[model samples]
Structure formats: structure tokens, C-alpha cells
Target: MILLQINQVARLFGAEVLFENMQLEIQSQSRIGLVGRNGAGKSTLLKIIAGIESPDKGTLTKTKNLSIGYLAQNSGLNSDTTVWNEMLDAFTAVRQMESRLRELETLISTQEIDSPEGQRVLKEYDQLQHTFVEQNGYSYENEIRSILHGFQFDATFYQQKVQDLSGGQRTRLALAKMLLQKPELLILDEPTNHLDIQTLAWLENYLQNYQGALLIVSHDRYFLDKVVTEIYEIARHKMMHYKGNYSRYLTLKEEQLALDWKAFEKQQGQINKLEDFVARNLARASTTKRAQSRRKQLEKMERMERPQGAEKSANILFKIDKPSGNVVLQLEDGEIGYDKHVLAKNITLDIRRKDAIALVGPNGIGKSTLLKSILKEIPLLKGTLHYGTNVSLGYYDQGQQKLQPQKTILKELWDEHPTTPEVEIRSVLGSFLFSGEDVEKTIGLLSGGEKARVALAKLAMNHENFLILDEPTNHLDIDSKEVLENALIDFEGTILFVSHDRYFINRIATKVIELSPEKSTLYLGDYDYYMEKKQEEAELLALLEQDQVKEKSVSAGKQSFQQTKEQQKIIRQLQRKIGQLEENLEQIEEEVSQLELQMTQPDNLNNHFALIELQTTIDEKTIQQETLYEEWEKASLELEQLDS
Candidate 1:
């Protein structure tokens, strides 16, 4: 059954047309992943379908009883409400039903069907009760609570109000509410923006089992693959449908592009042959009519439009300056964190020119703080920071610094560089997707996304060798992220950045430094390779534990004789385990090195979702490796104790 049908949709912002003559149909139980460059009218189209916004020209049709639930990119909750209360609000209908059911119950016991007043009350009561039960009014709240817990909403968090939670937490809560509403079609915009790997996986599972249709906009390739069964790619002012996941979409797209090329080539060949025949034979009496016929045919033949130029997206075409020196930036013997907590201590860092560094950490572990420390905004408490020769610093603050209240958008950008020409400046700003009237908007009036674009426009001004970026992708739509990633990938200078966007990190990071409560360790590779190394480490740990158990069993036999044998066995095991860890570590490191090099290639970033999964798997591996190493050390010490 068709859940919803959108036909010939057209949305215009100013003079630019978002898309025209676009058509898409949502089937029952279908999952569609909507993808396009930023500013492609995806959100606008979704709103038109949801009846939240009107399209300039379009029609959205849906079946009767087909309820729709939409999740906006922003947190859709009253600031003062508690997390638990917000979820319950999703069931406004159920709340009404419950109240009505209670009222019916009061009259049910006393009313008789035969009495006119009693009959009226009794009939109304029975009908309301049936409707309540049909809607499953009783269990919805309880079920939603379970789902909230699944999304990492602990019971304690339920009492915390919306105003107290982080933006990420609010996004998750909103997701939970939508899940509870149980709409016929669920439209989620940038649903994975603030989600962790675990919560993302949970959502994937929930959606996979969902009976209703779903359409979501996300840059998380892994989440899209795990949930969406179809993809709608909006580009060149048209909607193109693909039959499978992100991988399949890429594969099918490549094939289609190839076929399109071939078709154009074949048509050209025919046109050329016709032209040759006409040129030679047009003067001959017998061939005059034939030439005329060929000319007519040529006129009727439709030529393909040339594909957009190779570097069509960005006009400036980012080119980075050469590295200044060996040491770009370094932190020595540093304690980094705010008051009362230390993020990383007894820490030293050595950064070299042209080395792409990815700053990674869990929420609240202070990756952002560490970035701030490098900027010297946060006091290092007890550390010396150093910079290399002529190392001009270009900063991409996580908040995208245009976030600071200012007069106008143009002024926010202009404040950064006073000398840049207005024409050149606007051209650079346009490359980041800000155009015309957008440059005039006040900083206080700009959306988070608009502010981010303005910040990027400012960053584009500095031709610095060392770029310090903090979540450059936070507000960038997928298209802008890709453009930014491509630019970074092509950049010749050094980069040290923090981002929650795994897709972007995998494409550019030459190294990953995971900031943990225990310690910050460097994984010298791209996201995918890191995961592989971590997996090998986990398996090695598992094997080590098994071997240790076997060694203990052998060590348990006799007092004197067994003691000597046990000691000897212990020596061999220690030697063997140490050798194995060394070997395992080397193997992972080697693999990571190769993968890191491969990630620099353009083809590697093509499948962004694959990279995300690879990162999540790597993170799990790193944790397992840490646990194994701790166990191995403890066991080795005990073996020494037994030897004595």
C-alpha cells in the first residue's frame, strides 16, 4: 500500500529553484534514505509532506488514517519539561483516552441501559472504552518508557528537565517520543547528528522492525545502511531513486553514469556517421533526398547535456600552503581539563607539519577542552606549549565562532579579515554556500547552520599551514560536509581537529588520538583501520585469557616438582604472551598504517557509511585491548609471585 505520494513538488527560495517536477512515493513498511547536498530543499520537501510547511507548487497525498510523525533537526521540546514528561506528551491522544476512560468507569457501575439518561451514559462509556482499548491506550506509556531506557535514558535522567539536558540528550528524547507516537510515516531530519554508536545501533534495530514507512536525512552512512532500504538522491534539481542501501546506491549510480556515457557516445557516433554521409553525397542527384532525410533526423536527435565540470562545487578550489617546519604545535607535560576534572595528564604531544590529526573522546571527556587548551583559552595549569616557525594558526571553533553575537553576517566574516576585497570575499563566501541576501543577515538572527557557514567563510580567508578545527561539520549539511572533507583531504598543510562526524574523520584523519578517562592513546591510522587493529587485539586478549587458565591448571599439580615446572611454565607463558602482544600490536599497527594511506585517496571517502562502521568497531577493539593488556600485566605479576 502507498503510504504517501508526493508529485511534482517545487520549492523556491528567492530566485533559486530548489527542485522542480520531483516525484516520490512512500510504500508501507518501506525505508527511504533522503540524501542531497546542503540547501537542496530536502527539509522543505519533507515539511510539505508532513503538512507543516507549504511548497510553492506541489501536491502531497496520503491514505486515510495514515498518521505522520516528523522529527525536526532541532530539539522539539518545551525547555521547562522533564524528559519523562516529554515522552508521555507524545501520547496526548492516549492521555485524553485515559481521562475519558476514567470518566466512563465512574458512570459504568451505576448506569442502566434501559433508563434514558443511564442509556446515554452507558452507550457513551462503552464506545469510549472500546476506542481506548483499540488504540492500546493503556500500554503505550509503559512501552515508550522501555524504549527511552533503550536509547540510554536511565531512570535518573527521567527526572531531569529538558532545560538541564544537553542538545544531544534532547535529540534522543525527541526520537523516543516519535517512536512512541507510532506514526504511519516517520520523517527524521539529521537523526544521528548527536547520537553515539550504541544508540544509533538501537535506532537501526527499531527502524528495521518498524511496520510503518520511514524517511530520514543523515550523514551517518552506517545508520543509513542499517535502516534505509531505498535512497532518494536529490541533485541537479531532480530526484533520482535508487533501490538499496548507500553501498548499493553508489554501485547502481556508477553503473547508471557509465551507461549514460555510453548512450551519449553511441548517439554521437550515429550523428557523426549521418553527417559524413550527407557531406559527401549531398551534391549527388541520388543522394539529395537521402541527405535531406539525414539532416531532418539529425535535427530530431537529442544530445545529452554535458556532465557538470570536475571541480564544479567549489570555485576557489582549495590549495593549502606547504608546512612551515618539523614542529607545528606541541604540548609538554600538560594537565588538560576544567576545574575538578583532568581530561589528560602527564601528557606530551608532538605534531608535525602536514600531519592530519583527529581528536577523539567520549562525551564530557574534554576533547573540546583540549582543543581550547591548545588555543590557550583554557589555562593548561602546568604545561608549556610550543609552536613551530612561521606557523600561522587558522581556527575552526566547534561552535563555528560566528556563533558569537555580532552585528551582521557579513560583518562577522569581515571582522576576521579587514583587508580582503568585497568581491573576492563574497566569491569565497559563496563557495561555502552563503549567497546574496544571506550575507546581510545579522549574526543574532542567523540559524546555527548559517552561522557555521559564515565561520567557514572566515576560515577560508587564512592561508595558514596549521588549521585547528573543532567539529567543522556540526551544522553543515551532508553536501557541505563532503565539500569540506574534499577540501581537507586535498589540503597540503597540517590539521588538528575534533569532530563527532565519523564519516568526515575517516576521510581525512591520518591519526586518531582517543581521549579516555584512563589515558589518551594514539591510533596511527584512519577510522576503518583502527577498528581492524582493535578487533585483532580483542581476539588476542581472549586467547591470552584462555592460555592463562591453561597455564594455571598445569601449575596446580605438585608442591616442589610442580613449583619448578610451574615457574618454568610461567616464564614460557610470559615470554609467549609478551611476544604475542608484540606481534598482535605490530600487525594491527601495520594494517592501520596501510589503511591510513588508502584513506587519502578520493575513492576511499566515496562510501562514507562503511567508514563509520569501521570506526565504531575499532573503538570497541581499543577498549578490549586496554582490558586485555591490564589483565596480562596482572597475570604476569602473579606468575612472578608464584615463582618465588
Candidate 2:
């Protein structure tokens, strides 16, 4: 069943066409991922669907009475209502019906049973009651509470005034309200900004089972791949629909790009051959007729103009410097978190050179604080951290303080690279989405994404050996994020960044850090490895719970003091083992980097013996990394058996 259809949609801003002659249809079960460059009008399109804005041309028709729940990128709350009260307002219709039913009870008490007015009131009351029940009024509160609980929001925060809460908190409250609304069509823009990994996972699961259609405007590729089964690429002022997730879309898009590039080359080759024949033979009187014939053929040949892709999203290739040492950055009993609320415990982390570590946790787990701790901006409650000698550090915040608002694009980088020429400054800015007139714009005038790009461009000036980024992909469009992701993947530096964008993390992160506040468990694995470990942990916990239930019937206690104590001891031991394994893994990773450096050196190329030796060493390092993870996992199982 088609829920809504956008036909011949067109919008213009000052003679520049944002999107024209665009057509798209959203089905009842459709999960569409909207993609475009920064100024391509994705948000405007969403507004049109939500009835918040009108298109200059075309029609948007929906199935009759289709309810819509739109969570705008920045939806402000004016009413002084708490987060919990704000959510409960979605139940207003049922509440009104219930109130009316009570009023009718008063009327029925004063009227005769034989009177027509009393009978009419009684009928209306029954109708209202049925509608109330049909809407699941009985379990709605429980469902709302569960949704809020899933997001890691405590009960105390629920009653806090929305006006008093932070911007991120308001957005979370708005999301909860929308969930309670449960409209037929749900539209979300950049929904993962304030969400933690656990919350994001819960949202992914929620949308997977959602009965409503979803139209998401997000740069988080991980969210898109998990939630969307189809993609709508808004390019060149038109909507191009594709079947499958972002990964498949990437593959098909690359193939199309390659095919177009080849076709353009083939056409150019033919044009050149014809022009050559005409130029070389035109002066010969004997070949005059042939030359004239060739000229006519050239004139008659229908040419295909090459399509120019959006340059804003182009790849920014970089030359990464070599990894330097075995130790990147090591922490000893680090207690990192925000304020007095200690989110992370005794985090003895070791980030080695050439290691790409991604901080993975639910939102508000002080992932950013951990990065800040390493930066020395935030004090570690208890720990010692050391970075290897000659290691450089580059910081990229999603939209944090890096580029000054008053600073011009050229001035921002030129100040850092004083010895560098103006032409080099222009070149760096151009690669980062500021070119020509854009380079002249002050940093204050730039969009969030443009500002982020500028920050990255300036940071690139340092050529840092380690990057600490906090949600670097937040404001970046699909294209810019991809470019940044590719650059990080090829970067030869150690990276410890906090990101909820799983796709970006998966591309660059060789290791992950999962922070569990209540349990204070930190798991180290790559994106996929972390996921696998998570599932295993969940299953283990469930098994433990089942065992406890069995013990309740047999022993009439929650296991025993000795058994419980033993389990706790084993858990701590397992955590220590995992930490040790990570340390070993870092060492192995460093060796691999060293071997690669040796193999790539000019002196070693001619010496096959040395190259072969380095290759063997690299192979050994990989085996060691894998072996450590397997052993760590095995040891974890032994700890789980302590309570048995």
C-alpha cells in the first residue's frame, strides 16, 4: 500500500533550482534513505512531506487521514512541560474521549432511561470507550516508559522541564513523543546526533519492527544500512531510487561511475581520431574529398556530454606518514567520565601506533570525555597516560571548537602554516569544500558541514600521527563523510575517535571500546567483532539468569555467597584477561606496521631476502592479533562457568 507519493516536486531558491521534476513514492513499509549534497535541499524535501513547508511546484498526495510524526533536525519545545509530560501529550485524544465518557456518566445519572437524549449520550459514550480501547490505552504508558528506558534516560530526568534541558535532551524528548504518537509515516532528520550506541541499536531494532513508513535524512551510514532497505539519491535536482542498502548502493554507484567514465573516454578517443584525420590530410589536394567526408562525419556524430558529479562530495586523497612506535597511547587505571558521575572505571587502555581505535558506547558514556582525557583538556580521575615520542595529535570534532568563527578560510590554515605559500592554502581549502568565492567567506558564515571540513583541512596542516575525533561524521553529507572515511582508512596514524556512525567506524576502526557504566565493562574489538562479542555476552547473561532461577527452586537462594563471590571474581579476571589481550594485540599491530615500513623502503626493494623476511613478520603479527582475541574469548567463557 502506498502511503504517500511526491509527484513532479520542484523547489527553487533565487533562480537556483534545488530540485525540479523530482518524483518519489513512499510505500506503507518503505524505509527510504535520503541522500544529497549539503545544499541539495534534502531537509526542504522532508519539510514538504511533513507539511511544514510548501514546494514551489508539484503535488504531494497521501492516503486519506494518514498520520505523520515528524522529528525535525532541530525541533524546539516552547511549552514548559517535562520530557515525560511532553510524551504523554501524544495520548491527548484518548484522554479527551475518556473525559467525555465521564461527563456522560453524570448526564446518565440525572436522566431517565426511556428518554431519547439519555440514549444518545449512552451511545456516544460507548463509541468513545471503544475508540479508547482500540488505541491500546491500557498499555500505552508502559510502552512509552519502555521506549524512554531503552534510551538510557532515567526516570528523574523524565519530569525535568523541557525548556530547561539541553538541546540534545530536547531532541531525545521529542523522539520519545514521536514514538508514542506512532504515526503512519515517520520522518527523522539526523536522528543519531545525541544517541549512544545502545540507544542507536534499540532504535534500529524499533524501526525494523515498526509498522509505519520511515523517511530518514541522516549521514550515519550505519543507521541507514540497518534501517533502510531502499535509497533515494537526490542528485542534479532529481531523485534516483535504488533497491538495497547503502553497501549495495555504493557498489552499484561505483559501477555506474566507472561505466560513465569509460564511455566518456571512448567518445573522446573517437573525436580525437576524426580530428586527427581531418587535420593531417586536409592540406593534401589528393585527399581533399576524403577530408571533406571526414569533416561531415564529425559534424553528424551525436556527442554525449560527460556528466559532472557533485564536487563537494569528491574524495580527498592523502599521503599518510609512517607509523613510529610500538606504543601509541597507554593508560593506567584511567577513570574517565563527565563530572562526578563516573561513567568509565579503571580503563587501562593501550592505543598503539598505527592502531585505529573507535570509542563505541551508548550516547552520554563520556566517549568524548575519554578523548578529552587523552587531549589533557579533561583531567583523568586516576591514571597515567603516555604517548610515544614524535607522535603528532590532530583533533576533529563533529562541530566543535577548531576553526574560529571570525577567521577567514585562508587565514585559518595560513596562520598555522605561515611558511606555506598562498597557492598551497587555496589548494587545501579547495579540497575541503571551500573554493573560489567560498575561500573568501568567513568561518562564521559556513554551514556545520562546511565548518567541519574547514577544521579537518586546518588539522591536516599538522600531519598528525594520531587523530582524536568526536563524531566527525555528524554534519557531513553522504559524500563528504565517505571522503573523510576513505582518508582515515588510508591514514598511517593512530586514531582514537568517538563515533556512532557505524559505517564510518567499520571502515576505519581496527578496534573498539564499549563502555558499560552500570556494569563498568569495557570490551575491545572492531565494529563487527564487537557486535559478535555483544551477542555472546547477552547469551551468557541470559544463561546465567536461567541458572539462577534453577538455583532458586533447588537451594532457595540467589546461588550462594561463595558462588556469587566466585562469579564476581571470575568476571573481574575475565576483564583483566581481555585487557591483557588488547595490550598484546597492540604490540602485534605495531610489529605489522614496522614490517610494512621495512618492506616499502627503497633499500629493501632490490633485496628479495629482506622483503620476504618482513612479509613473514607481518603474517606473524596478524596471526598473533587473531590468536589473542580467540584466547581472550575462551577465557571469558571459563569465567562464566565459575558460578556453575
Candidate 3:
């Protein structure tokens, strides 16, 4: 079924037309990706479909009772409530039903058992219970917990107030709640903005099982390739649909453009031939009729418009004035971070000339801090970092913090190279997409992407032998990123950069360094190779944990057969404690099951107070069960030790 349809949609920004005559239909379970360059009105189109904005000229139709969940770029949840409570609020209907069910249960307990009022209450409760089960009331908390875990928001974070959360955390919370709401259509704009590689992987897995339709706007080509089955590209003030993932779309689009260009050129050749014949023969008396006929035919011919090629992307080239030593950089047991606290320690790295190394880690794991330490902008907490001979470093700060806000784009580059002529500086700036009056614009007035380009322009002028880039691809558009990637891939100088853009990393990185608080691990390959190794390591770790558990069990079994007589009393006590813990576990498990069943009933689902009470009870029981299991394990271990 078509969940939504947009016909002849037109949007205008003053006199500039963003898009026109756009038509789209979103069918049930469709996985559609919307891709376009920045300022192409992709987000605006999403807002229009989401009912957050109205199209200037268009008709939008939706299936009856269709629900859409839209998450705009960098959108954060605004709530004073605790994180857990905010998520719970997404299922207000379920909570309301739970409340009513509880109230019905209370009334049933008070009324005569054989009375019609009591019987009606019981029936109502049964109906509500069934509805609650269908709505997943019994497993909602577990679902929330699982999603929170996937987002790296643990149990401790659930108690944190949403108002106190960081912007990125709030954005994650918004996404989490939207997923919990389970709307028919989920529209996400740049959903991968703040995600680390691990969380991105988790989200991909989660969405693969999602039941609803998905419409995503993202610059992450890798993400789009994984999740989207169809692509809609907004270009040249028009929307073109392609039936496949991003990679397939690229191939199909290229072929289509090639065919279009060929047909256009062919038509142009025929038109020129007709025009030439008409011009020469029209003046001749013998050929006047033929000339007139040719002219008429030319006039009647349908002309094909020239096929529009890919838009121009910024040209980036990283060149070094001189070559550095083979050993470009060395870090010996280095510790990086603040003076008082070390973010990562025992790190050792040896970078060679012309090697492109990508540093990757989870958010807040100090990838940026390590970069700063390497640049010596900040004091290293410990150990030593040495630069090889003749290594002139050029740093690209992702935040563009080094750029002076008061300076114009032109001045920013010229000031760094006082001897360079103004024309030369302007030429370099123009290469980075700053042209004419754009050079006069103050750095403060520039957008993040503009600032990034300005920084690149400055870096280009430095003529450094080595480049240390921090989140270099953060604000770059897809095309710009690809250009930069290609530039770096071709550059002879060494590179050490931190980035979460897997596509860029894959394209440019020759080696990967995975950072953690404890240490850093090196993988001698690109991003994909690094990921494969990480997966293998994870599987091995899981197997090790399983082996440890089995070892403990085996130790217990052996000890049971070889117990000393003097240890008999202690073993008996341990066994008694274990039995008690097992009993408590069974009781808690039974109570949890019963509570879940009760939560599914109509009366319990409708009773708000009862629902809250039941949820609280379940939470307590779960905690208690976990505690008992730990105690039971400890007792069993102790019993085995005594026997041995």
C-alpha cells in the first residue's frame, strides 16, 4: 500500500526554485534514501512530507491514520523528565490502558464475586490484557533497555535528567524514543551525525529488522548502502528516482547520464547538418524548395536538452614542499589527555613517510586528544613523541578553532604566507570554492562547511611534509569528501587523521589504529579490514568468557568429588545458601512472569496507578534476581574451594 504520496511538489526560496514538479510515492515497508548536496532542499522536502512544513505548491496525500516519526538533523529532545520516563512517555496509550486495567482489578476485588458488575469488570480486564500483550506492554521496558544499550546509554544513564544531557546524547535519546514509538513511517535526516562506528553498526542491525517504512537523508554513503533499497537523488532542481542501494544507484545514474549525453550529441549533429544545408541552399534558385523543406523539417524537429553532468566539486590537492624521513613519527609508550587525567595510555605508534593512518574509537575516547598531543598543541601526560627529520606539519582542526573569526577568508590564507602575492592567495582560495566576494566574507560568517574549506585552503598554502587532521571529513559534503579522499590517497606526504566517516577512511587509510582508554591496537589495513579483525577479536573474547564459565563449573564438579571431611560443615552451609538463592530466583522469576501477564490484561493495562506499581515491582524483582544469581555463583565457588 502507498502510505504517502506527493504530487507535483514545488518549493521556492524567494525567486530561487529549490525543486519543482517533484512526485514521490512511499509504499509500505519501503526503504528510501534521499541524497543531495547541501542547500538542495532535501530537508525541506522531508519536512513537507512530515507535515512540519507545507509545500509552496503541491498536494500531499496519506493513508488514513498513518503515523510518521521524523528526526531532523541534530534534533534533540527537550524534556525535564528523566531519560527513562521520557522514553516511557512515547507509549502513553499503553500506559493509559495499563492504568485502567489496574483500576478494574481493584474494583473487581471489592465487588461481589457473582455480581454482574464484577463479571463485567473481569471481562473488560481480559480484553484489555489481550490488547496490552498485542501492544508489547509486557516487554516494552526490556525493549527500551536494549535500544538504550545499543545507543550506549546504559542503566545509569536512564536516571539522568534529559535536560542535563549533552546535545549529542539528547539527539540519541530522540532517535531512541522515535524507534520505540514504532510509527508507520520513520524519516531520519542525517541520523548518523553523532554516531560512532560501533553505534552505527548497531543501528544498522536494528533497522534491518524494523517493520515500518524508512526514509533517510544522509551523506553517509556506506550507511545508505546498508539500509536503503531505493535512492532518490535531488539535483539540478529536480528529483530523480533510482531503484537500488547507493552503489547500484551510482552505476545506474552514470549509465543513464552517459546515454542522455550520447542522444543529445547525436541530435545536435543532425540539427547542425540541417542548419548548414538550409543556410547554403536557401540562396540558390535550383535548391530553394529543398532548402525550405529542410528549414521546415529543422523547425519541426524536437531538440534534446544537453544532459547535465555531475555538479562541480571542490578540487583538493595535498602537496609537500619537501619529503620527510622514512620514519615520520614515533610515539613511545605515550599517554595522551589532560594533565590530571589520562584518556589513553601505553600507546606506541611508528608512522612512516607516505603512510595514511586513520585513528578511530568510540565518542569521548579521546581520538581528538591524541591528535592534539601528536601536534604538541597540548602537553602529553607521559612518555615521548618524536618527529622525524624535516617533517613540517600542517594541522586541520575539525572545529576550525585555529582560524581567526575577525579575518576575511582571503586574509586568513595571505597572513600565513606574507610573501605570497594577493592574486596567488586568491587563486588558492578560489580552488577551495571561495570566489570573488566570497573571499571578503569574514571567517565568523562562514558556515561549518565553508570554514572547513577555508581551513583546507590555508593547509594547501602551508606546503608541509606531514598532515595531522582531526575529524577532517566532519562538515564536508559527500562530493567534497570524495575529492579530499582522492587527494590524500594521491598525496606523497604522511597522514594521521581521526574520522568517523568509514567511506573516507576506507578510501584513504593505509592502516587503522583503534584507540581505547587502556591502549591502542593497530590493524595493518583499511577500515573494512580493521572491522573484520575487530569482529574476530570480539568473537574470540566471547569464546574466552564462555571457557571461563565452563572452567568454573568444571572446578566445582571436581571439588564436589574430592571434598575433605573437615570442610563438610562449610560446604553444607554454602549449599544451603545456594539453595536459598535458587529459591529466591525461582520466586522472582514467577512473580515477573505473573506481573507481565497481568500487564497484558485490559483492566491492568487501563489502570495507570496499577501499571506504575507493576513496572516498579518488575524492576525491583529483576534487580533482586540479578543479585541472587551473583550470590549463588559466589557461594558455589566458595563451596568448590572448600572441597578442594
Per-model C-alpha RMSD: 15.1, 19.3, 6.4
| Candidate 3 TM-score to native | 0.86
lDDT of each: 0.75, 0.78, 0.87
Cα error of candidate 3 at position 88, Å: 1.3
Q: What is the lDDT of residue 272 in candidate 1?
A: 95
Rank by lDDT (best first): 3, 2, 1
lDDT of 1: 0.75
Best by lDDT: 3
Lowest-sum lDDT 10-residue window in model 3: 549-558
| Structure candidate 1, residue pairs in collision | 221-609, 531-618
lDDT tens digits, residue span 1-644, model 2: 99999999999998989898888898999999998788888999999999999999999999999999888887755559777788789898877766675676567668775689867765675566456556765446556767887767766677788899877777777887788888999999888878777788888899899888999988888888899998988888887888888888888777777888899899999999989999999999999789889899999999987956545464465544655587878887778766666877768677787788887766666778888888899898777888787777788876657677898888988988899999988988877767898888898988888788887887777777888888888788888887888888888778888887877877888888776553234456678888888899889878976564323222346678797666676666776786788788688767766765665576774444454455456557666766775696587667545533
In candidate 2, position 597 carries an lDDT of 60
TM-score of every candidate: 0.70, 0.77, 0.86
- Best prediction by TM-score: 3
Clashing pairs in model 2, backbone N/Cα/C closer than 3 A: 196-362, 196-363, 197-362, 328-352
Return the lDDT, model 1, position 459: 72
How far residue 313's Cα lies from its native spot in candidate 2, in Å, is 3.5
Query: Candidate 1's error at 37, in angstroms?
Result: 2.3
Which is superior by lDDT, 1 or 2? Answer: 2
